[model samples]
Target: AQSVAQPEDQVNVAEGNPLTVKCTYSVSGNPYLFWYVQYPNRGLQFLLKYITGDNLVKGSYGFEAEFNKSQTSFHLKKPSALVSDSALYFCAVGGFKTIFGAGTRLFVKA
Candidate 1:
């Protein structure tokens, strides 16, 4: 069985600061990791994925994540945060039946 854990319930950042949302996973075999963002009252939107290759993967909205195999962690990052970037983020791991972590809400203030 595979499971995803996001330790943070919410992340607060200044408007232009870099932001990160942590995620870790445990699985039987190699895991496929993904990040999705959900705006208020909206559906989950695919942000990025790490299927294979390059430890660092880039995705929509200037977001990127590092896939650390040894640590079993995939942490999402942004060079600079925006007020518009504030949203609920989810980290998921798996193939057919993906397991998603409890969402982390991002609050970016100007």
Candidate 2:
């Protein structure tokens, strides 16, 4: 079985400050990790992914994730968070079967 966990229900950050949305995974085989964001009444948007190669992977909207095999984690990070970045974030892990975390709502305050 493959599973991902977003321990925090919500992550609050200042508009100009850095932000992190933590994610941990457990899978049987080589796993694929992905991050997606959903805004109000909108569909999920791809953020970043970690499959292989570089441990540090960068993606859309100034986001990046570090793939740590030792820790079994791929936490999303942004150097500076914007109010517009506030949304629901999902962490997914998959080998053959894909599983999504409960989701973490990010709020960036001005």
- Best-fitting candidate, scored by TM-score: 1
**What tens digits encode model 2's per-residue C-alpha lDDT throughout 9-98?**
999999999999999999877889999999999999988888889999999999999999999999999999999999999999974566
Superposition error at 38 for model 2 (Å): 0.4
Q: Considering summed lDDT, which 10 consecutive residues are worst modelled in model 2?
A: 91-100
Q: Give the lDDT of residue 47 in candidate 2.
A: 88
TM per candidate = 0.98, 0.96
The TM-score of candidate 2 is 0.96
Model 1's number of clashes is: 0
Candidate 1 lDDT over 43-80, as tens digits, reads: 99999999999999999999999999999999999999
Model 1, 29: alpha-carbon shift in Å? 1.0
